[model samples]
Target: MKKRYILENSKSLLVLLVLFFSSCVFAQQNNTTPIMENQFWKNVQFGGGLGLGFGSGYTDISVAPSAIYNFNEYVALGIGAQYKYLKQKDYYASHLYGGSLIALLNPIREIQLSAELEQLRVNVNLEGSNSNSLDYWNTGLFVGAGYRSGSATIGARYNVLNDKNGIYGSAFMPFVRVYF
Candidate 1:
């Protein structure tokens, strides 16, 4: 009985050892490597930024969020949204909603150039005045350059929002974004 017990336990231990070695080899073969294949479609990345603008009696802050579906290594297109709130003493309390189309050109592994066209709609309501709310449509053009790695990007942009009655500015905006 003692000899039989030892043989059965030894057989079980050998099977366990074989499974561990096979799993280790499989894991080594499946190690995550940076995807370098030139394919027509790749994994998509999404991110956004918060920005502030100041000029000509307007002080506004914006949250701009974006998403990109990478079609290849050299080209991608994205859709983004922006919302801005403005405060200027007491003249107007304003809200703006906008959307943009982004095009990206990658020059190297860590650098990219982007161009965006955005359209915004602004609504203005006067404080303490029972006046009708005013609304207008405005368009903006943005051009920027960026640097990126793993899951973070930093960029600088120059933007021009059309000059309308109460919502227009040109700004140099520097922003950072993170991806999960």
Candidate 2:
């Protein structure tokens, strides 16, 4: 009777081992790497804007360069730097240099919303008999939305913290953005 019991237990153990090995051989395999491991740099995008305006005695030239990291399809965070030179013949000339932090959201593929906080250092030099120079810092908060297509977005933004003595002429401004 003891021999029969040992034989029965051996058969059960053999069956269990076979089943386990078969399941392991037939299981799916995953070979993909995680986002943080090899995809961090792939998710970053770079873009910016260049602006120029000139008339009789007035001139404006600006260059803004920016970069953003896309957390996903819906959210992005970025930083930007801006430099602007403005001159009005025989009146005044100003140099504006600044940086901004920006946040972007895309609820869908065709629309993008953004908010940016900008801080600028302004240096103004007056021309004339009573010539004077001034230096100050200016801050602005802008909120905007745009239509997106491929790599380009066209939008308009309003500065919530606009002031009469600010660097921009108006609270409303149009923008064209491209990312790659």
Candidate 3:
């Protein structure tokens, strides 16, 4: 079990790393903001991840929204919120809700370093068993790195504080992001 877990994490990291590097090739180089000097609106960004899945016997849905203030091209600070729902035929159903505060650094146009503090609530209930439900709160710090370009980002993080049955499921998580 341990070996299989390690292998899966390795694969997830490898894939995220590849996506990051590929995006770097097309990283933006626009560093001009003479007119918008220190304008809050001009230095803000909004983005996050949205996910939807349907399988032969299950359904998944999620939404994460975030906002950032670019201190400069090299640094940013942000906050985010998330919600997710999962249902499996005749098995179980679960919901995850969370929020996070984030810090990011960009040494180059294509590479970014990320850090975040997260708090989440995970609730689970077996099908047709509304009377018996389990819920808990999970808090953790995550450090990660990613590749970023004009409007897209790919990254991975390992929870510094992880629990086997935690909201994240595992210490390792990979994410794809889009910004507007």
Across 1-180, the per-residue lDDT of candidate 2 in tens digits comes to 543454355456546755774696466345546754457679889999999999999999999999998989999987799999999998999999988778899999999999987778899999885649989777777999999998899999999877687778999999999988
Q: Which stretches of candidate 1 lie over 4 Å from their true place?
A: 1-42, 51-61, 128-132, 160-168
**TM-score to true structure, per model:** 0.60, 0.78, 0.73
Tens digit of per-residue lDDT, candidate 1, span 1-180 = 543454355456546755875696576544445553323135567777787888778798989888876767777767789899987766887889987777787878698788777667788888767884778765556788889886676888876543333254446777575644
lDDT for each of the candidates?
A: 0.70, 0.84, 0.78
Q: Which structure among the candidates has the greatest TM-score?
A: 2
Is 2 or 3 the stronger prediction by TM-score?
2
Candidate 3 versus truth, CA RMSD in Å, comes to 11.7
By lDDT, the best candidate is 2
| lDDT score at residue 63, model 3, on the 0-100 scale | 91
For every candidate, C-alpha RMSD to the true structure in Å: 21.4, 22.9, 11.7
Candidates ranked, most accurate by lDDT first: 2, 3, 1
TM-score of 1: 0.60
Tell me the deviation in Å of residue 12 in model 1. Answer: 71
Cα-based lDDT at residue 133, candidate 3: 82
Each candidate's number of clashing pairs is 0, 0, 0
